[model samples]
Target: MNRKILVLFLLILLSQNIFSATRIKTVEFNFGGYYSATDIASGSAWTPPYIIVNLPETGIVIKNAYVEIEYLSSAGSAADVTNIDIYFNAGTSATDIVDNITGTQVPDSSGESNLFVARADVTSKITSWTNQPYSLKFVSVGSPHNMHSAKLYITYEYDDTSPIQIKTVHFPIFSDSLDGISGVISTLAQQISPVSVPFKYRCDLPESGITIRQVWFEIRGLRQSGGATTDGSINVNISGYSSEPTMTLDGALTDTYRFRYLSSTGTPAGFAPNTLQTVYVNLSGTANTNILGGEVVITYEYSNNSNVKLKTVSYFFAQSTGTAGSVTSFTVPVYLNEDGITIERIYAKISGSYDSTTVGSIEVNSAIAGNSLTSRIYQIVVTAAQISGFEFYHDLSEGRSYWYNGAPITISWTNTLAALGGCAVELFITYKYTSENKYTEFYRVFAGQTPNEVASAGVYNYTFNLFFPDPEYPVGRKVLRRTWLRGDFIEG
Candidate 1:
């Protein structure tokens, strides 16, 4: 997909009688954490500080990659800090273009400097990328941590062109890479081979039982040299569930059985020849009743060949720590809308200790959102009003609109309602972020805002100059043209 093709693609799609445009987007993966000798491992083409972004088995890849570094670790950099090599591994398989090349760490953006480290022009690799999990290996021949402080941005161009372009919303990513998630345990060993293809795969749960906040299922399979002949369908739902939590794909409300179509080339959802496609199920839902307290089964509906279907699967979960809080935050640094720029939304969970019947509010305030003086504020509802968790219908496109730029806002709450006091009545913020495009306080869009310290309880008012058919005249324009001729009207 080159500049010409991209433009042509957009034009061609727009020209469609039905006007179905592929959703084009960029997904940025923020990379941060402790980098030291402890993370070092030897191999040439291989390296220690390796990070993996487990992509779902079914999806589309549009373009090349980008690395934006807000902060880079100063681990191995010194007076002797040398150049380092970075490689983007295409699903751990073939060295696809843009996926196999290497680039030097952008010395200017390394260590203590938050900037672009380097971009592996794996455009070739990704252009031909079959739907599969993606991983990257960074080998520092000179200074380490030069690139670890960066974020990975990937563009996604899918065939589905729904009139609504808005997708999932998420909160900003705080430095503590593993903060919000809790009590995670790898319960089931990775299963190899679909021995009972088209049948159910089971994983037993602990007897004492654990309340699940999030369940991650990794479905993996390789392409059959020529093409994928497997159905590769799996449904996720817990029996004897304790609570009912809504589910989402990325952040949109979708069924438990996603990625039914893994193929991504010839077929709208078809896979490329010999390319691997891996699907990951990030399920967030509450059970009405306790889980069966025994077996957690994965029922497969169909598969062409036992070996061709999902050959392997991995299951894990994050346990909800029954803590109470004023508000939970899910903020992230995202873009409003720009060519090749990416965006994000928030997803949060209320402390389980709060009374489910209680009504509360979640407020999202951004630093730089569009042309408004104050950042846009969005309200999140879990179970009507009481905060429980991320619900699909409520979470999609809940972040900055395409008009907004990069501003990291705080997702906070007032414990006024949750003052139940039985649990820790604390407040959680997604994290603070300085926007790439900061406001000058006197911008054209003139973000006129009304600031108040008091609570309106969700009551607010707005006044706009709604009066014109043309952009030439400002809204609420009086008949200035007639005013100029007020003294004498020849016609009158």
Candidate 2:
């Protein structure tokens, strides 16, 4: 009788403690959309400039919520730039969540101009709000400073019971400086020729038939530089998109232009092709307006039901510039440290200052092995004629497959001297990996810049933010694991 009781007790204990993995999703709300920094001039409680934080109205359990603020200041010294007060108002009442929050200097800032990042955990307050549009207000203290941008991130625990899951794919639209001082979109392709941008999406798979969710196009920081009084406007027509989106800036106000477009329903018309895809994004705008900086963000969704999964990674290297009579070489590092990662392809976008009339060519070469000694694997050439504006972007296709071990691959390129300013290279690598999960999944996020290289001996002081994986939640983290610094060293 005692032996029978022991067996029953063990079965009951096992049944009571069933464990399941935690699932989480984080949504980002960008407040200022890459607009130029605004001066927070006075100390007196500045009237509230309410910013919207987009969150789902219902159906989810939020585990944690945090707000990250990025700002540029030339106010006083870093010491005088002490603290800022933050408040949130749902509708009727205003509650102070973080009072006198400290600011940490970003690694990129130097001298009197400083960049700062301030974070606050508002899990309790954010979870309590039962509606949409969480607006926030900021109050500065001590010396005045400039506010660049603010973002709200909310991570929620959700158990998706349905077979269909919504996926969001985001990629940069354009990262070039449009100088319109001479009254044209400059010499870039937006004015001279057509620019082709290639993006990837998972749809109509043989295993688990996927579906389209929605599409969004976001353009940020569209304005004329040098305080010029020339009104500027741009009309962007993306191939396969439903309609053309336009952004305009008034000559008198000096305010930056931001635009966002969302489809009414799931539109797979643009992404109907199942194989490799290409789309032409044309830009047309007014002349005599020097547009400084901007980016295009495309968002889409798909459905999955297979075990075969897709993973993508992007890395941004330091900017390199070439002189008029010198040969410039830039070595970029590509790291893929995942187990069983079969790399499909790599796409690179070299954006910076390029003159269409310049005479030069850039070549990319990789190292590979064949018989005995490893030889130069393959090469692709980019010439001045092919470059329309300040960007030369394409899918590096030389007909070869790449597999990742545990080491980093270095890609070096040499360019002849031409009328070029500076260039920054960003690479996107996609691969397929197997998982035990029943349905295929897709994960996407924008990549951040790599850390700057340190000098051997000098009084160099700068602060920047680096994202790393957390040992506790490795699955939840999406970031670059390894990076190498590549640039030229010149004595001043």
Candidate 3:
């Protein structure tokens, strides 16, 4: 009996050590709001203003992030290809536009026409912060298009040492067209009154053994018509879950967004698991106000139970405008703490101007590892007309993986065409490996950031701070992970 007890004690110790080692685990969260069958009119500005997606907070490390939108275009014909303009965070923050996209319409099983899907590589936008809200807007260019739905997928990694693990669920409440056009008695335009719009959605939280961390909701793209009389306000709340003035909308709320956040940190009641609750909203506001879209995001945090963790980091490189006909090569420095890192994806914003109406082209390429081109990473050939720009985000998984050795990740831009001049590029790369000593690092470029760090003859300093508190290993420890720097020229 004594011999058996000794062997069992040793086995338990060995297992604990193995599990405590740094490990990585990946997770993907999908949520969105805004589903409409009503065809948006041509030249409609960002209809259904935005769809909200809640992301994991600091303890979780994002490995890869992207957004996919599915919609219907060319409703009459199945063979017609329609060009649609998609904007991300439009008229809000981090506004990005992708225009002139020709989406091929496919036929469904019923032989119906016009189904389009578009994707955007939003790794940089999504991973920049934690527990933040993201919104997407759509614009119809050629013809009227029906927006089916919008969703966000975030793939992240976490480990045992993380203070907490987070999971989010989005319950879409009140997604319908509301036209407050005064004197227009249309079915779509409903008058604002108490109990005018009584909205409710069935919310079934996860029944698993988890604790509620935080809960929040957002009202997106609440704008008035072209001509309005007074400001607009809407009081929305979830029964038994909302506080006084759940969301206050009072201002030049034209094309604006609003949100409300509640956490256990301040509320003494402490949020309880609200399972099988029917959330209700009572919207009463001023007259002649148009509402585009809205969504509710609920985030839950609990003690991290996983022993594995993973992360993805990005480095930014900004290139200067090149000569008329030349290939400029940029050598991006390595600032990662670990050696032998592998890059997973590269996103580039290529810009140039064209004087003539003739077609022009820009060639961008990248090679990693050895100087002899051990790994051919990515190459993009963009052909544009008159004046246009390209935002190309490419994944390097097609080629064999090559280890980075603190050498410059070579990026070149060839703009030899005469029609296009002033070629420039902004590049960002996401790595595959996670740094054991860091969680996240930030870099910012500014002028006169400090008394000593001032600009000198058109040269400025990128000043930043790093703080990581490692109380103990494999436990309560915070570390610096990734960093990026981007700057714009002045007096342009």
Which candidate model has the greater TM-score, 1 or 3? Answer: 3
Q: For residues 84-122, could you state the per-residue lDDT of candidate 1 as single tens digits? A: 445555565423323221223223221121111233444
| Arranged by TM-score, best first | 2, 3, 1
Better of 2 and 3 by TM-score: 2
lDDT of 3 by residue, 1-492 (tens): 000000000000000112222333222332222333244555564433333344333455554444545444433222223344556542234357632244321112122223344454454555344445456666655444443345444555344465555554443333231311111111112213324343333333423444543343433322222222223434444456553232222222121111121211121122233332323334444322222222334445544443332223344454545466564776664444432344433334343344433333434555555342322222222211111122222222222244344445566655565545554554433343323333232222111111111133434333322222232354533333223332222110
Better of 1 and 2 by lDDT: 2
State model 2's lDDT. Answer: 0.36
Judging by TM-score against the true structure, name the best candidate: 2
> How big is the RMSD of model 3?
21.6
Runs of candidate 2 exceeding 4 Å displacement: 1-167, 170-214, 218-229, 237-244, 249-282, 287-305, 316-345, 349-394, 397-400, 406-423, 436-480, 483-492
Residue 45 error, candidate 1, Å: 8.4
Question: Each prediction's TM-score against the native?
Answer: 0.29, 0.46, 0.36
**TM-score for predicted model 1 compared with the true structure:** 0.29
Show pairs that collide, candidate 3. 23-309, 24-309, 158-309, 159-308, 438-480, 441-482
Query: In candidate 2, residue 346 scores what lDDT?
Result: 48
